[model samples]
Target: MRLNTQIQGQGFPIICLHGHPGSSQCMSVFTHHLSQQYLTLAPDLRGYGKSYTRQRFEMKEHLQDLETFFKEFNIDECLILGWSLGGILALELALKFPEKVKGLILIASAARPRGNHPPISIFDYVYTGLAGLINWIFPSWRWNIETLGKRSLFRYLIQQHTKITYHYLAQDAVPAFLQTSGFATDALNQALRLGYNRLENLSQIHCPCLVLAGECDRHITAISSQETSDNLPNSQFYYYSNTAHLFPWEIPQTVLNDIDYWLTQHPEIFQSN
Candidate 1:
């Protein structure tokens, strides 16, 4: 299955993978920023965004698609940057095809993602529903429930996931979250149930890796992200305070700088390619 992919820039390939309930569009910021210095490829995994498929698929299928994506693009070696669920896929890719992956840049993602992520509560459902209604009714208005209700829903969902109040959500986040296909969302959760852990096997992936985490992340804890780095044979970890899972969106420049610095440190990744 050939996924719908976004390609940019003109140097060593750097594949950017999005999180669960996300599409290639979600990784546009990274693609645009890195495109100037690297070849950035962002693909909408099967069942998400423009690649939506009715046939059931899990992480295993997604991995197969990515492998095919590489062959389709004549990509023999590339750096990978993954966010949330995409990070898990990157680890799997590096493990399964170590020769193809030169390095990794993981953001707000975990190798051993929790199998039992909290479900959206009734309150979340109510608020999200209200927010939708409000947005529909006042499509032109920006200050009403469109802002308040959507932000409230974001906070509630994050609280359910992390038991902490996430103070901010970028305006784009709401639309991105809403655009996710229900089928894709359910498939990811099912994939998680089937298992996505790589903790014990992490040592097998020896390539350079840079793991970035949000200290205030509501979904994945900084410690968990750090643990992923710790288990890897060659990896570095960094955490940003007062940031949440969407820090890449909240502070795009900072995240980009961090990635740039790490890439500079591992010049071999590009030089070898």
Candidate 2:
């Protein structure tokens, strides 16, 4: 698959993968900063952005495509940062290509495949359903400049400078979430049907992993990040106190700082592990 990609900066490779409903553009915030120190490449995964392909959406296919894409760039090894669904894919890639993956930074991701059923909460269903309906009706009005500006002064400044439209939320954002959720649900069902717990094989991943969770993330709770950290011998966990599921977007500086510190502490591990 010809994945839509944006390459920037210069130095060691750092591939940024966005989650479902998010395109490479989502990583624009980090690329401008990270690119100064590393060669950052952010790609829109299949079925989400400009990647043109009609194949069935599956995790394996995504992994294979990324492997191929990296190889084509002669990227034998590099750091990887993935958010949400992208984080799950990054984990699978680290397992499948251990030698090629130097370090991993996962944001709001879980090791175990998520359950299909949403928790018993009418509000959850109602809110999500309403969001879906609004998305379908007006797929270009998900983010309102005034609203976001009021929510976070930092985000408002970014918006003012970038002028990123609310269309991202209405059109690409909501539909992307719905699609990935459905796909993950199906993958979970298939794993159960095959009598295999997908996460049972996580022990094979030995790379130095850093799992970051948002304290207020309702989708992937901090408990889930703790569970994932416990399963990996070489993993560390951190939680952003005032962040939500969109921690990376909300606190890019903090995430970058953590990653820089991690690289400093694990220089040898990235080079030789």
Candidate 3:
């Protein structure tokens, strides 16, 4: 599969993978900021954005596509930045092809995800259900008010999964969510249900890793991210206050600076491939 990749800058490559229900566009903020000093390649993985084919993919298939993507671009080695589901893929990529991955920056992601068991509390369920019902009836996306207005119906659905407030949905994130293929979404969910655990294999990936988690993330809890860091042979973990799974957009500069600082700490990330 030839992924539609957004490439920018001209230095050591940093491959950016967006979360589930997202496209490379979701990472554009980071790409634009980081590209000033480092080359950034953000690809629309299969079944998302322009890569949508109505085809379902298993976890291994996604990995194989990434390997093909690397070959096509002659990317022998690079740092990987992944969010949520993309983080799981990044971990698997490092384990499967250790030499090709120099380091990993995980954002709101986990090695061992809960699969079908999301940690939504009873209050969350009630709140989201009522919120969703209200949105469906009144359609907040249609509101004329600027501050409270939403532009996409998908944003409403996303709020049901994450603890993020409705109006806080990042503009860039809405389209990425809307572009996601239903087949792709269903297949990934099925794959997760089958099992997405990687705790046992974290030791195999010896490269430097920086795990960033949202303190208020509902989907991938802070504990899961910390546990992933704990298993990794070499890793650092940090959590942001008042942030959820969408922290990248919520605090773009902070996330960018943290990544830049981490990369600077490990000069090996800039070595020629």
Which predicted model would earn the best TM-score? 1
Residue ranges of candidate 1 with Cα displaced over 4 Å: 115-120, 129-151, 156-179
Query: Model 3, which residues run further than 4 Å from truth?
Result: 115-170
lDDT of 2 by residue, 169-268 (tens): 4444554554444444454346446642336666787778888887766666777776787787689898788666666655667777987788778775
| Quality of model 3 by C-alpha lDDT | 0.77
Sorting all predicted structures by lDDT, with the top scorer first, yields 1, 3, 2
Model 1, 1-273: lDDT tens per residue?
889988899989999998866778878778888999889999988877678686766568889999899999999899999999899899999999888899999988998764233576787777766664555555424564345554554542332222112212233344556666777777777866787677999989989999998876767777889999999999999888766677776566788898888889987787663
Indicate the residue-level lDDT of 249 in model 3: 64
Candidate 3, 192-240: lDDT as tens digits: 7787788998989989999998776777888899999999999999888
On a 0 to 1 TM-score scale, where does candidate 2 land against the true structure? 0.73
Q: Pairs clashing in candidate 1?
A: none
How well does candidate 2 score on lDDT at residue 182? 47
**Lowest summed lDDT over 10 consecutive residues: which window, candidate 1?**
159-168
Clashes of 3: 0
Clashing pairs in 2: 139-170, 139-171
- lDDT over C-alpha atoms for residue 169 of model 3: 42
**Span of ten consecutive residues with least summed lDDT in model 3:** 144-153
